[model samples]
Target: MEMNILIERLQALMAKGGRQILGIAGPPGSAKSTIARGLAESMGRAAVVVPMDGFHLANDELVRLGRRDRKGAPDTFDIAGYRALLDRLREGGPEVVYAPRFDRETETAVAGAIPVGPDVRLVITEGNYLLLDTPGWADIRSRLDEAWFLDLGAEARQARLVARRVRHGDTADAAAEWVRTVDEPNARLIAPSADRADVVIRLDA
Candidate 1:
């Protein structure tokens, strides 16, 4: 989608809305967070971001479950908590709703970090599993007013994932290995969920 067209569509949605929730779903390296954050930034105080990353299971919990190696997988997240929070956002009651935020350096989620005010019409959420057809994720589609999927090519997506891992302090070799062994499988699962989105955005175009 062209930048102007995307912004205009969002503006129109805001104009017609009582409460509007936008979900951006895609593979790990597809830049879902980037686009969602950009939209909220452009909309200023009228929009707020409530990222799915904030639902990540703490590292110790993952260790106890023996799933630490597969940290980014769908099952590793607190899907139930995420869904309940989305429900609250959809129902709209609190004068200020507190949501969690993920800390990359610590690789954990901080509770009550994002304060979403009642006046905000748009709640922008981006995550890998928003459009997934799995049992736990199915109801997410019903809660969203609109959902967008970022479609990026395989080569570019892997490259971006590798770069992100390195920037987050992973060694080059470790990043490549994790992308190959872990991220790729998750990406394959996520790619098919694009069909469930209201819009499939081709970022490379």
Candidate 2:
């Protein structure tokens, strides 16, 4: 699927008069967040983004558990916390829900950082593992009405990721090293989840 196709489907769904909770999943640096932002912006106020990164464990906790080195690993986040938030969103009840937000600069998830209002009809939650139907992750699919798997061309996503790491304070060599060492492996693991997505998208810059 292309980006325009997604926008078309979104508009169609909106026209049909039912809320669409669309999930976008992909490997690290695959442009899931970028697509989510675009979707929300295109949808206007009816769409709000609630990121899965918001459940990232705090730095202190990760350090305490000796998982700082593997900061973006599956175990480094509070999956249950994310689960609760998704569950609430699925219910679509009245009242505002304040969710945590991940800060890349600080590398931590700050509580009550994003406010999800009562009237938001669509939510775009993007992450690497939302479509992963693994042991502890089976709960995610049930929470989302539909999910899209973002598939960026390898060279493009990797280049974007390397530049991102460099911009965020990593030396060029170190960032490349980190991307190859940790990020690439995680990206490989996330690919399998694409099978579970309702839509598979190949997005390009």
In candidate 2 the C-alpha lDDT for residue 46 amounts to 84
**lDDT of all the models against the reference?**
0.89, 0.83
* lDDT string, candidate 2, 1-205, tens digits: 5668889977776675656678889988888888799889987888888888998888788989999899888878788888888878767778788888888877778899878788888888888878777766778887887788888877888899999988899999999998889889889888988889887877766
Q: Give the TM-score of candidate 2.
A: 0.94
- The weakest ten consecutive residues by lDDT in model 2 span 11-20
Q: Candidate 2: deviation at residue 202, Å?
A: 1.3
Each prediction's TM-score versus the true structure:
0.95, 0.94
Clashing pairs in 1: none
Model 2: how far is 51 from its true place, Å? 0.7
RMSD of 2: 1.6
Error of 2 at 86 (Å): 0.8
